[model samples]
Target: MAHKLTRLVPVFAVDDIERLCAFYEKSLGFVQDFRYGEPTYYVGLVKDVVEIHLISTSSPNARQPWGSGYLSLLVDQVDDLYRRLKGFDAEIVVLPDEGITAYAIL
Candidate 1:
């Protein structure tokens, strides 16, 4: 028997979990599944999939260096998604082009 890799959910160290959650919800359209007090921790779902878990970086253990990891998402229309995210207060870490995709650090 062989085991197969199924899914991967990236956890982000965010300074403000609520802000991060709002960014994902407004910018990326991910829905909130659950959250803790002070909105320090939260789980978001997209298309019924648990795509991201936002955790507060106030704790010493939660803080980590930015640009230390990468998250790859497969979507039906990348251009449409990019357009939708344009209104949000997010930094364009990378812009999409031939053979490359855009990246935003929100």
Candidate 2:
């Protein structure tokens, strides 16, 4: 039998854990699942069964260590989610194009 893949959870390194957590909780409706660290350097969030992990980094003012990556979320209503996010001040790089099935934010 072929190997079976289960759920996927993406981890992102952020400068500020609290700020990112706030964004995910308030903006995306994710709930805080767990946290760690003295100054709170690690965090986990969940929406439904999907999990997102975040790690705080205090690196100098340089380029991110991770070259490039992005997360793609498939929602029931993409247009509604897009409209809801429009009220906030997030950088939307890719809007739903003719060939694209989802919008992207950076």
Give lDDT per model, in order. Answer: 0.69, 0.81
List the candidate 2 regions with Cα displacement exceeding 4 Å: 1-6, 59-66
The sequence of per-residue lDDT tens digits that candidate 1 reaches over residues 10-104 is 78777777776777788777887777655355445564565777667775556577558766667768777777777675676777878566555
**Structural similarity to truth (TM-score) of each candidate:** 0.72, 0.82
Off-target runs (Cα >4 Å) in candidate 1 are: 1-6, 42-45, 60-67, 99-106
Candidate 2, residues 23-94, lDDT tens digits: the string is: 888878999999876778778899987899988776332246647778877788788788777867778888
Query: Which pairs clash (backbone N, Cα, C closer than 3 Å) in model 2?
Result: none
Q: Give the best candidate by lDDT.
A: 2
Alpha-carbon RMSD to native, per candidate: 3.1, 3.6
